[model samples]
Target chain A: MRQSRLVQASLFVFLAAMLTGCGSHVPLEDLTISLILGVDLDEKNNLVISESSPVFNQDAKQNIESYQLKAETVRDSRKYFDALATGEVTAAKIQVLLIGKRVLEHEDWFPVLDTVYRNPTFSLNTRVVVVDGPVSDVMFYVPPDKPQMPLHLKEVIDKNIDRTRAVISTLQVLHRQMYESGMTPSLSVIKKEKDVEFTGVVLLDKKGKYVDTIDAQNSAFLLILRDEKKQELTLTIPMTSLGEGGGIFHKNQISFDVSRVKTDVKTSYNKGKFDFKYQIAMTVNVAERLFPAGRVNQKELEKMIEKELKNRLEDMVKKFQANKIDPIGLGIHARAYQYEQYKKVKPHWDEAFAESNIDVSVDVRIKSMGAVN
Target chain B: MKMAKPTLTLPQYIFLIHGVQMGVGVLTLPRETAEAAGTDGWIGIVLSWVLATAASLIIIQVMKNYPKGTILDLLRHYFGKWIGIAGTILFSLYFGIMATVIFIREALFIQAWILPRTEVYILIALLSIPSYLIVRKNITILGRYSVLVFFMTVWMMIFFIIPLKQAQWLHLLPLLKEGWQPILDSVGTALFSFGGFEIAFFLYPFLQKKEKASMGIVIANTLTLFIYLIITIGAFVFFSPDEITIYNEPSIVMLKILEFRFIERLEIVFFAFYLFVISVTVLPLMYMTVYCTSQLAGEENHRRHLIWLLIIAFVYVVLVPPTFDQNKLLQRLIEQAGMVLAFAFPLCIWAYLLILRNIKRRGN
Candidate 1:
């Protein structure tokens, strides 16, 4: 019995040792936590990094926040942050990366982005945004009313890009677009206007350098062309009557409130010529009817709207050709359909894209008007 | 004291076979097959299963004819004592290599995913102690424990299948675009995935219902094949063929993408689930190794001798490759050893048995 007790004691001790060795933890005080970071380029063409986190009081309520630090590089920023913050700054918990306009415009942002991608702690799924003004200004924007302002910013950006009618791009998408052949990426562009600001999208070239800004209207068109998830976008079309008694022609703007939009792109190549067709099917709510009110001729109005939409869509396709930006990934379609042709013309795809013949067709089916007529 | 008699049913045998056959190498099977066959890896797996079934049948038939004898006893009966001892040593060495390879692979996975800072020696010690304790149990107890763990492992696969909605079915399309050469190459690599079916030779004598052993082997191979198909198709669909080739552990990486409302990293949950499966697999291999060792040594107190043998084996495994790359080289050597034991040895035994039967008929 005594020997059995000794054996049990030894087993218990062994178990304790094993458990202790396996279980390793980091204390909260020892961790350098970074909530958000904003990156931009200074006048010297060096990287400017700014990081921020909320300050908590003894009772666990957030108090006055700390000042943002500007460093020459991300590594220096971490060193500066480690001295200021209580613990070492861990990149694993970084929620968002905000890039300033100057940084986006800089010729070499790949090195900075590559560092983030290579870090084990930093996730490729983290949200990336381009700030129009100084990144520090955007970082320090804390509305007095909202305590969780950073989370609020994330929610607003995510809702605008994902659920609402705005273009959305993540780090993974950006990396794939920049690295993979036959594709270019676009990021949501944020412009700060003292109190009220507009957020749209900026297109990035294959090398990940900022190319040009897409206006809100063009951004909407680009979003539609890309077939990204969107809700309630307004499309204005100039109407022309094909037959007599077609809308009286005075109120020329036919407004379409797009409820549902689906687009299919087909590519066919024949004898060194690429034929591209974009088929758009959409459900629209007729916001206005300017024709005589006696009997609202549904077929005439539908024809007018369809004709106007086809014209506008053709113009949009022409604009995409002029800019040589295939937001719809037409090049991807071409490569998939005609591999041999694509290979022969692969080097001059951009020049070929500018000269490619793209045909646009719209088939709109009006589901219902509002409660009116 | 004599151990309690085991009442082995077909389902228990099926569970044991499934548990043993599915191990660390399976996670890399698709990529390995793809490397060998290009796009026809799935075909290789199907053909390998066919070969495995035939091999399993030969083993069952041989053991069923001698219901009270194991492979060791049968070897002694057919070949002389010296040859029997050598054959037993070869099998023990094969099992030892397999156990060592599995331990290293599990260590690398744990280090890469779960605990990057943890020492490799500590991980080996932790896994080996529990496995040694489990291996000390009788075969009946081991079988029963395997059944319990088998169900637990199956349920964990539900987490792996959650990413199926995002999978591209087109990646698996354009079938046979590369022709039959790749398919044959894939079959050679995938034959290793079906390695543990030969455990039937060791397990057949312990079964209470001897006739059911063949059915049990078929059922186990079928279940393992089904699981392999699900994970292979799932990985292929979720990742492009190029991406699948790049990932070291595609199944684990696929699991990493899945996020629940509560849990952020489902890979951790999978790692925990796989821990149970690994233990279940390691116990049988360790038991078989010790059993073969005792038989070769001609020891009466086999159980006591088994404890020391396991310790020595564990120490030997821990001392081999110091880094993950070197460990992979060791694993390749072990797989080559597995090919000889699993395929070549069984084919030789079956041919010998058939020739002996023919000679007896002529003499009669």
Candidate 2:
């Protein structure tokens, strides 16, 4: 009985010591987890930090606020925020990263991203975007009705990419493209307009430096060329059968309408050259037929549509070459097909790509006419 | 010395074999196989199963000739005392190294996933206690518990197929594009995953009915092959090939991606299941090590001797560093040694026995 009592006393003492050690490590109760982080470079080249979190009101409506801080470096920015804010500064809980245009152009973005990537708490799946103008201006521009706007940015980017070809880029995808050969990373760019609106996308080189932007029409072509998605497109072709230099049949005359398009890409290598054969099969609903307006034969209609698509596609490929970008990943396909040749020519691939020959083939099969027909 | 004890049934024997066969090696089998064979790694596992089945049958046939004696005793009978002592030492050393490898790997896995702050020595000590106690039990109870845990581990595998929806079928495309050399290399790596069949050579003496035990080994091999096939194919089909190459523990990573409404991380459940399987594997090996060592040392009370061996294993495991990379190196050495002792040595014994039998028949 005495031994049993002694054993129980010792066990209690050990438990007490453990509890005291744990008590010292206890964290504060009112800690807030930051969900989105934005960074920019100010005029003095100092790093500026902005964070967004969801806010709840007494009526249970959701609001959001963007916290701002400026310091000499990313680590110092966190220290500055900690001194001013109420909770701990943790990068692990951040789900979205936004960079200002000036910061992206002047400073090395990789060092800032490397800190996030190496942190164990941070997830690799966080969505990253670039904002135009100073990040502080965009961060401070909060809407009157809704405060939780960062979450909306993620949804808007995801939905737009899914619905059309605006292209939403995640951190993992960006890292892979930047690291791999013959590929460059691209991110959706947003700039605040009057009434809290955003526009445009900025392309970056392999090193994450700003390159160029494509407007709406060429952006649509870029989406189609990449085979992201195709909803409705307008094509113009001259009608050849009306008569020589006649109305609607004249050469260089425009006959265009909105139609559905589908494209397929195939790659092959022979001897010392590479070939990309594009087979574009499309079906057009006759919305407006200005030439031979009675009823056109399906064969003649298919041939004319095929010709028009081929010309436009060839022009688009030329534009991509002129811009020196391969969003279609033709270089990746080439390396995957002929890895040995790629290794030998990898250093000079940029020059080779600029000089490489491209072939385009379009086959348009018009399955159904529009309701007007 | 001639005492009667409870004996295990055929189903119980099969369960013990299956549980022992599927140990730490199965966790990394798919990644190792894929690294060698690319997309056709499943074929290498199938080929290994066929080869392991043939080798296991030969072992069973040899054991049937002397129903009351183990391989150690048979070696003593056929080749005399000195050679048998040497053979027994080699076998015991192999078991000891395998135990060390498994224990270190278990400690590293637990530290990384389950208890990050826990000391490696404390974890090793705690894990070794249950195995030491369970191994001291009679063989019949050990066999029964192995069956219980084997079924529990199989039930745990049902959660693995959840990631099938995310698999990229294009990664498996251009099949057989790399040719036959990679498949052969994969078969070499897969042979190590089929290591536990050699337990039959030592176990034949304890079986109640020797003839039935041979058939039990076949059933056990079939079941193990099926389980390995499911795990290997499931991992390949669920993860992209690039992802599989980076992860050492593919199954645990697969489980980490799964989240239920009630459960946050299913990998914790898997880690617990792995602990159970490791205990199940270690107990039988400790028992065999003690049994084989005492017989070779000419000791009377084998149970008393087992206590000392357990202490030695405890000290060794505690002193070793709990790192995944070091454990991988040790595992490679154990595998190379096992290939020679378990597979190649058995073929030699069978050939020698055949020669001896022919000489006696001719004299008669």
Candidate 3:
């Protein structure tokens, strides 16, 4: 028995050794790691697939190289790129996918992304951004200050998302909004004017077509309305409604850093209309003041800030209603809180939401007036 | 019979059954149940747990009549040689198909996620090596290995909470959106995931505390139910009702959303470690199939048959390339066969034993 055990051990080692040398093995150094992939539509309506990979070859001066190909699908571009590169194009490291404005304008951007969802090699955690222009611009554009464009772009989006300046739209989250009836898909939008800048977020309708873009200033408000506030959000409001100051200083602008924000959406169906009251409660610390600190009345200042915020949020809601979109997921609240009523409008929830009576009320509390006060 | 020893402790039985029941099915439990029952998938899990527990208890009852022998001996002792041979062949075939299905599924997952470049045949071969080594051992080690694996991998469930941060709890509302018909249809799919408990037909006779065997299986079923319920609910809340269907493996997709400061694509690491958990399912089933096959071959010891069974399984996996459609067909086949063998067969045997006991008492 002991002799037989020796033979078995040797045979096992032999097999392990032989198995390691089998087919379909790609070494790490031999792989071209794609950090970002871009999808766009060509002039002839063909699919344009672009990929940015960090150049690791010591001889190369550039840190990143991008390759673009016009193909029928994303998977087909890999074969074409393989011929141009020295290594196998591996997409498991894909950090971001940028969709061009032209593609987003098309009716079904979801079908173009079928490979990202269906292909096992694709990373579902890949952050998806909607480019305001052609995705090739963002994919190929390299900033002088940034070390690597792909890594820099990912960090930019990640930082904004953490600070609630941009919406968090991973491929998984995008898939959820695309599939959820009560919610429409939205992605962080980026524009390449001089440097890569986060322009805010682009809203997609139920069919995954772009509806409108929210600027960076209101994106925070949009996030607040969605109850997705992750970190401290500071908003500078122009308080024109507040009375003019008599001194040399003009207290026309007041900026406060929001320490705490709580938004509660109450949905009630009555008389064939869905009524939603969004109560936004915020506590803030005075960050900057155009007027002198001694003249500031904390109670009066809080009221002015509250009134301006409420009006702005009301306007934002009206914009959403006018655009016939629910990026804030009001339909989600309607579905959860009032399921019976929501069922009737499930087929055309955006239209129902557009006609719904939505009210916004902001209650701002000045937690601290800063050190001077 | 030299190695015939009743070494399986009560807790070991629970872990063994639990380990078996938790396999590739857990990975896709949400998508499967959601497809059938929509947001009400958790209901199907609860129903399947109850049914699996009942079926397991009946198998335990069947074993109570003959406390000293495996199901093979019981069949032979009750039905005489020829009929017993038929039953043994049938049981062995059931286990063989099950092990093959698990083998194919595991290799396919490995190829899909971790080693996209690795050939399925190579994965099957590499997977069988571990099964051969483990199945060659006694049941006590298998049980202990299972317990260790359970503890080691159970903490991975903590990752589910990461995605729960993004969860919209509202998705789970409007309970029974499609009504009872979908939930009931989903019960079949959920029951298929609970197929591993049928191993109790063989393990019951070897349980150290025979009376606690029923409760042990019940506890195992309940634990499986709880795990499935949490994962299914997590997926339901994490993905929208319509969105959850698009994911073939919702649990893995849920893991993909989690990004750590140091780690990127966490699902790759999770899938690598998950291989250990998947092994507990494949290893014991491999042992059972070999044991049953050797029993039918009139061998007192099943160790020699282990290598041959592994080869056949490897060849089978290589022969059947698991495309999406082919894998679906195989899963459906196994689910139907498991329902018959795991749920229905034991009840038939229990009834047969009842009638036999009544006739013998009346004759006396």
The candidate that achieves the highest lDDT relative to the unseen native structure: 3
| lDDT comparing candidate 3 with the true structure | 0.86
lDDT of 1 at B84: 82
Q: Which ten-residue region of model 2 chain A has the weakest summed lDDT?
A: A20-29
Q: For residues A303-371, could you state the per-residue lDDT of candidate 2 as single tens digits?
A: 766676667667866765666656555665555555556557665565555556677776666655555
Clashing pairs in 3: none
Q: On a 0 to 1 TM-score scale, where does candidate 2 land against the true structure?
A: 0.73
State in Å the error of residue A223, model 3. 0.6
* Leading candidate by DockQ: 3
Per-residue lDDT of B216-251 in model 3, one digit per residue for the tens?
999999989988998999999988887788778889
lDDT of 1 at A251: 57
For every candidate structure, what is the RMSD over all alpha carbons to the true structure, in angstroms? 4.5, 6.5, 2.8
Q: What are the DockQ scores of the candidates, in order?
A: 0.26, 0.15, 0.61
TM-score of each: 0.85, 0.73, 0.93
Which prediction has the highest TM-score against the true structure? 3
Tens-digit per-residue lDDT, A1-373, candidate 1 = 9997996799678768867333757777566556677788766767777776655448645542434556766766777777777656777656567888887776657667666754444654456778887877767776666555456666666677654345656564565455434556678777667632446778766556777777666677777666764645876655556334335564555566888888787778865678888888888887766544453366766766767777776887786678776555566666556656766776667667767888877778887766776
Which candidate, 2 or 3, has the higher DockQ? 3
Clashes per candidate, residues 3 or more apart or on different chains: 2, 2, 0
TM-score: model 3 vs. ground truth: 0.93
Rate residue B180 of model 1 by lDDT: 87
Model 1, docking class: acceptable
